[model samples]
Target chain A: MARVIVDVMLKPEILDPQGQAIARALPRLGFSGVSGVRQGKRFELELDGPADEAALSDVRKMAETLLANTVIEDFSIRVEE
Target chain B: MARVIVDVMLKPEILDPQGQAIARALPRLGFSGVSGVRQGKRFELELDGPADEAALSDVRKMAETLLANTVIEDFSIRVEE
Candidate 1:
């Protein structure tokens, strides 16, 4: 089975409260030196066939339609061996 | 500024309902051939300096203590150019 990875992250212009919270919490937890943090989603898909052009195309459509909200988030896809 | 990527994923044995929901919806949406799906989290961290061993070590602690629930999830870290 071929595996596909899709990473969906909020646009740089959008404010990410989740990321801010982590940045704020870091110092208190005794971990420092991190300047910024952004949290996002990752999807791993198992396909029945090879992750060729056709499969990747289908995955892109899936990412655009179901995996990510394109207006506020952007997604990129990668195929795994 | 150096960037580090942390990808947190559910344990292989754990049940992923969110992934299952997406898998079920794929066929109805006219997308097929996907056998399974797993959903996870990705964190992008910006640091003040290079991603050296010390920095990666600190990030690992962050991932274990805050970013990932070690009981049910596993995380991997990568340094980005």
Candidate 2:
């Protein structure tokens, strides 16, 4: 089965509270030298069949329409065997 | 400057509520044949300096120490020039 990886991230201009919370917790956890932390989302999809260009296109549409909020987030897709 | 991409995902045994929400929304968005969506996190870090093996190790530690929750999540890191 084909596997696809998708990444979704908030727009740079947007304030990411989740990322900020993680960043604040880092030093307390004993990690220093880390400056910024932006939180996003990752998705792994296992296709029932072979992944083709058409299937990928459909997935892209899915991402735009439902998987990602285009108004505040961006997404990327990677397909693998 | 060097760039690094980090992906964090929930353990397979963990039920992902966010993923479930997204999966449920797909059919309404006109995407069929899509089954599962497990949500995770992605981080893009711009290194303050060159990225070497040592730096990568440090970043890995950072991920373990703060960026990811070992109890429920796993993470992968990639560095690029």
Candidate 3:
């Protein structure tokens, strides 16, 4: 089986309160120096066969449809050989 | 700013219905060949300065506290130089 990796991140313009919360909490925890934090997602797919164009295309469509909200997020895919 | 990448994934024994759903939906969408799916999370911290050991240790503590549930999830940290 092949592996498919998808990385999803929020757009820079979007406000990520979760990340901001991390940034703010850091100082309190005595860990200063972190300017910011951005939280995202990663998905791995174990395909039954080879990682080919058709599988990639289908996964892309799936990303657009379910994995991400195209309006405020962006995603990239990498298929392992 | 330096970057800290955290990769979080479900433990092998845990059930991931969300991923299973994706596997089931793929064939219906006319995209066969996927054997399994696993979903995880990634957090990127844009530090104000260099990614040192102290910063990493702090982030690891935070991961244990807020970022992940140690019960069923496993997380690893990578600090960018």
Could you estimate the TM-score for every candidate?
A: 0.99, 0.85, 0.86
- How many collisions per candidate? 0, 0, 1
Which fraction of the native contacts appears in each prediction? 0.93, 0.55, 0.86
Q: Return the top candidate by lDDT.
A: 1
Model 2: lDDT equals: 0.80
Candidate 1's C-alpha runs over 4 A off are none
In candidate 2 chain A, what residue range of length 10 has the lowest lDDT sum? A29-38
Q: Per-residue lDDT tens digits of candidate 1, residues B1-81?
A: 799999999999999999999999999999999999999999999998899999999999999999999999999999988
List runs of model 3 lying over 4 Å from the truth.
Answer: B79-81
* Model 2, span B1-81: residue lDDT tens: 677778889999999998888778887777767677788888876566667887788789988877789899988899855
Instruction: Evaluate model 1: give its lDDT.
Output: 0.97
lDDT against the true structure, per candidate, is 0.97, 0.80, 0.83
- Chain A TM-scores, one per candidate? 0.98, 0.92, 0.90
- lDDT string for model 2 (A3-37, tens) is 78888899999999987887778778776555777
Interface RMSD of each: 0.4, 2.0, 1.6
Docking class of 1: high
Q: List the residue pairs that clash in candidate 1.
A: none
**Which of candidates 1 and 3 is the stronger one according to DockQ?**
1
lDDT of 3 by residue, B1-81 (tens): 788888788987999988888788877877777788888888987877677777788778878877789999999898756
